[model samples]
Target chain A: MIQVKNVTKKYGNFKAVDDISFEVKDGEVVGFLGPNGAGKSTTMNMITGYIDPTQGQIIVNGVDVGKRPRKAKKQIGYMPESVPLYEELTVKEFVRYMAELKLVKHKDLKEETNKLIEEVGLKEVENKLIRNLSRGYKQRVSLAGALIGNPDVIILDEPTVGLDPKQITEIRDLIKKLGKNHTVILSSHILSEVSQICEKVVIINKGKIVAIDTPSNLEEKTKSKNTILVTVEDPNNKMESIKDKLKEADEIKLVKDNKDGTKQYAIVSDTNVDLRKKLFDILPKEQIIIFELKKDESTLEDAFISLIDDSKETLKDNSQTTVEEQEEKNLEKNNKTKESKNKQKEKNKKGSKKEDKK
Target chain B: MWAVLKKELKSYFLSPIGYICIGIFLLIFSIFFYLTAIQSASIDLGNLYYNTAMYGLMLIIPILTMRLFAEERKNGTEQLLLTSPRSVTGIVLGKFFAATTVVLITLIISLMYFAILMYFGTPNLVPTLIMMFGFLLLSMAAISIGMFASSITENQIVAAVITAAVLILPWFLPNINESLAALDLMNYYSKFPAGLLSATEVVGLVSFAVMFILFTVIVLKRRKAVK
Candidate 1:
């Protein structure tokens, strides 16, 4: 379990991770979903105690990471991004060393190291120098390093970034296996991977958390309408009149015209309403041929993009309002200054006229 | 800490750096052996060790210590090391002793030169050993400085350059002031060459090693906050 409270990391004036707080429950597979430079790696680094947070407290397994890094770090198994490894070491040696560093008892160190090597599927290449292994194997070696002590929490930063498709699936399965026991927190820009592998998704953008929920919940929350795309052959040109029969449908518009004399129309309705059955029955009675009718489903990818875009739009609106407010103040100040200058000019004219009369 | 020590020692032999450091140290020692010991026709191994410690260590220690931390930082393996539960002092000492072990191996091999001296004529074993002990102490002090230099940079070349400068610049200190000669690492070897184990020399060399080892640990610990 990990609790990050008001954690912020700043480099000079740039806040890499800005006042972000999140928690990973025991045995929860949490996905840190973000675009590039979204502070995912920085957050992971802070959680693992690899880098100190500029301001915050990260508690791991009830121990504050800053105050007792050694005890807190003992609970975390971190595989950093890019699969950093000791190229000079064999896979077995690396894991053994990691086991020892984690303060594993000398008695169990050997058995644990070999078990981890087998778990990560590096048994065949266990004796190969890490430098000679493939990228995917190197990643496994790094994973074995993290899994050496069988820590309660596993933190992986973009674990499947550069792997082949086959390797990606293998690694994802390995992570899912890891999640059954350890609290797994992995960051990735790949939406499908997160959706398939993680139970809870935390979307971060621009050093801020945009949304956090179950993947399906996020998809459902971002679904604004139930859209049904119906392709039909309306020889009688009755498609336009079909709207009159369906009262629940909010809007219907011709989407595409097929050269084969079939037209595709999109019907939109309120969320949670299904218009497919009505359209299926009504079109036949109206002498229209229904070729295709299916509802367009929203996925986690759409949810992710929409959430990130919405946050960015809101940020733009906030800055625009501040600029407009500042402009309004400046205009008011200019008007007051102009009015005072006019009064002073009038006073000077009145003095000149009085002097002329004298 | 033993984990890191074992890996560091293993890596030394696994890579060419270990062989290169030992090869160059022995090469320099052999050259000095012929020039100072055989040419001077003297059985005293003191001058031979003094010259080797002065010149040979400047080359070998940088090669031995430059990659200790610099390579890890560059390859991003420092993330693995720093995130581990091991203390910074432990990692520093692990690397320090590992590099020292390599120097110890080369020094042990240099005993063959002393063996050769015995075949030709009688050599004073006690003074020669005191010189070797002084040589080991001086090398430890220099290696610690090199290790500190490596921790401050990711570039191994820059680390080596900084380490070499640290070792070489002290030799020039006496040119600036007479009192500064006490700070020269080579000055600590003077008592050993005369067959004496002066407390001042031993304590000075040890404290110097301890000071830099402590500095290396501090640099690594501070980097976690700033990195």
Candidate 2:
């Protein structure tokens, strides 16, 4: 179980993640969907205890991350965004080292290391140095590092960012398999992948969560009209009058004129209406040969774009009011500390030295 | 702590850095061995270690400690270390001891010169061993300083330069002010090389190492909020 309660991360005056809260139930796979700089990685880092939240609490598996970092971290296995690994060490050695760092038992270290190496499909390159491996293999090595000790909560930040299609599917399958026994929180830009592997999604925009629900629910909410596409050989120009003939059809739009002398038309109708059967029966009677007939479905991508646009408009209106209030608060806080860090304005830059001097 | 220490030690040997550092120390040791012991026929082993501690350490300590935390930060491996179920103090000590152990290995190899000194005549074993022990303390203090420098930056070159500056700046402090002469760590080591055990020097070196080690841990802990 993971609970992020009102988590906020501030680098100087910039709020990387602003007042975001969410929860992942045990054995559930939650996907974090967001545009770049949306604080997806920052939230995962806080949950893993990698970076501290400015004003919030992250409890992982019942242990507060800030209060008991070691205990909470022990419950989590984090594969960072950049896929960091010891370039000098081989795959097996790196996994063994991670096992040791994770406080895996001395006796079980070898067996655990071997199992993870095989699980991530790095057996052939187990003895090769990590620097010598390809990006996909390096990614797998990082996953193996995270999986060591069989941590209860697996937090993978952009796990499939850079990979071939085959490799992506393999990793997606691996994550789905992991989701069966362990609670997995993964972030990705791939909406279809999220819909496939994740049971629920938390979509964030500009450091705030715009929507949170199952993929189907979000798609359903954004899906306002039902449209069916029909490709036909209507050389008689009879497609335009078909909307008038079919009383159920609201709009008939000529989608495309194929070079093969066929026309595709989209028939938009009222919600909860199926026009495929009506078109199949009526097109043949009108001497219109049907080439293809299918419903136009609204996918997660459409849901994501519409939600992002909605959030943008809301932000534009709120910016005038909220920016002022936040700046006022930030000014008072900066005056108290006399230290506004000039570093880490870039996204995902880890570790800071400004506070170190103080 | 032991895990980081062991991994760091293995990393040194895996990349030829361990051999490079040992080689540099041995090269410096051989020069001093020839200068003080072979040419002048000085039976005192203290002068050789003292000379090496004065010169050989500045060059070797940076190489041993520059990559300790800097490379980890640069390569993003610091995430793995900091996010693990380990305290900041343990991680710092682990790297500190790892660098100190590299110097220790070179010192153990320096015993070959000591074995050669035994061929000519029996130099007092007690003072030589004490001098060797004091050299370890001085190296520990220097390693801590370099480790502290490494923790403050992600660039290995910057960390090395910072460490070299910190180590070299003290040598000239006494020239600027008579009171500042006490800041020179070599002054504290004067008695150790002369076959004498000094409590004040032991305390000074240990405190120096402790202060920097604590600084490293505090730096890492504070970075959690800002990073």
Candidate 3:
């Protein structure tokens, strides 16, 4: 288990990571998701004992990383961002050196080096110097070094950033294989990769965490029920004024114009309104034929973007907060009361369904 | 510590820097041997070690130590060494000993000059051995300073320049003040070439080496916090 408590890394006056706290349970695969310069690498470095946090305590496994760095570091295998390795050493020699650095027993050193080489599929280049290896091979050599002692936690920073699609798949598969046995924390700007591999994702923006939950749950959070996308073929272009007939619909946006005389528009309405049925009833009478229509389903990518934009909006609000702290508090209170009233209405709807069943 | 030492030595030989340092030392040693022995009609090999330690070290020690830490920093391999489950002292000492091994090899190889001197008159064996031992101590002390120079910068050329300036500055300092002669590494070496192994010189050289090694370790440890 890894617990980061109130961690804040300040560089001069800039706070690179601000009071961000999260936990990775034993054997869990967690991802640090953020845009560029989002402090993901900084957090990984702190966990590996490579750098000290300005203020905070990190407990890795059971040892405090700040107090007992070596003890905590021994349990972690860190493949750093740059894939640093001795260019002069052969793959086997490098892995053996890493094993020795990890204080692997003399009896098992030789066997362990060979095992990691074959494990990462570096057996072909075992005798080749790291200088002569390709990027993919070098990445595998770094992974081999990190896996030598079978550390309990393996932290990889941007493992697949500069790889081809084929190499990306290979390395991702390797990480997945390691995830079954080791607690893995990987940071990537690629959203689909995290959604595919990580059990829990910590989305970060501007040094602050925006959300921490399962990827599917984040996708669900951004899924809007009131938005429906429709592909329509309108001869008289009456789709523009269709909102006048459907009073419940709030806005109709022309999303795209197909080259084949069909156009796609998104219909927006209240959260509780089913806008698709109303659009179906009103479009034909207005001389518009609906070709295709479906509800909008946000993927993990949308959730990541929306969450990031949400944080950006809140930061803009925070600038005026110093002058009107009380006004903002009251506004937030009013919003919370409105949210509670909506929740009460939802509960009443569920109760009415139960009565119908009775 | 053993792993780092072995890897450093392996890296040194795998690159040309180790051979280059030894080659430069041997070249300087041979030139001095000709000047102090053959041309002067003398068999005193002690003077050759002294001359080589004085002139050849400024060239050789910087080459050996310039890339010790600087290249690692530039290439990002310092991250590997710093994050390893080892003490900062151990890594510094590992690199220190590795560079010292190259110097030791050059000293051992210089016995060829002694063999040639044996064909002439018998060089006094006690003074010659003491000079060789003193030369090793002086080189170790200089190596620590050179290593410290390497740790302070990431550019290898800058490290080499700083190391050369540090070593060459002390030679000319005594012109300003007589007490400044103490800063000259060779001032403590005035006795070793004479046939006596002075206790003060031995302590001076070892203490200098220990202090600089500690400085290198401290600089590396402090970088983790401030980096």
Most TM-score-accurate candidate: 2
Can you tell me which runs of candidate 3 are displaced by over 4 Å?
A235-248, A271-290, A316-358
Candidate ranking under lDDT, highest first, comes to: 1, 2, 3
Give the clashing pairs for model 2. Answer: none
Off by over 4 Å in 2: A320-358
List CA RMSD, all candidates: 8.7, 7.9, 16.2
Show pairs that collide, candidate 3: none
For model 3, state the Cα shift of residue A311 in Å: 2.6
Measured against the true two-chain complex, the DockQ scores of the candidates, in the order shown, are 0.63, 0.86, 0.53
Pick the winner on lDDT between candidates 1 and 2. Answer: 1
- Best-fitting candidate, measured by lDDT? 1
Cα lDDT for residue A308, candidate 2:
92
DockQ of 2: 0.86
Please name the candidate that would achieve the greatest DockQ relative to the true structure. Answer: 2
Residue B184 C-alpha lDDT in model 3: 81
The 10 consecutive residues of candidate 1 chain A with the worst lDDT sum are A110-119
lDDT of 1 by residue, B17-133 (tens): 999999999999999999988999988888899889989888989889999999999999999999999998999999999999999999899999999999999998888888888
> What is residue A229's positional error in candidate 2, in angstroms?
0.8
Tell me which residue pairs clash in candidate 1: none
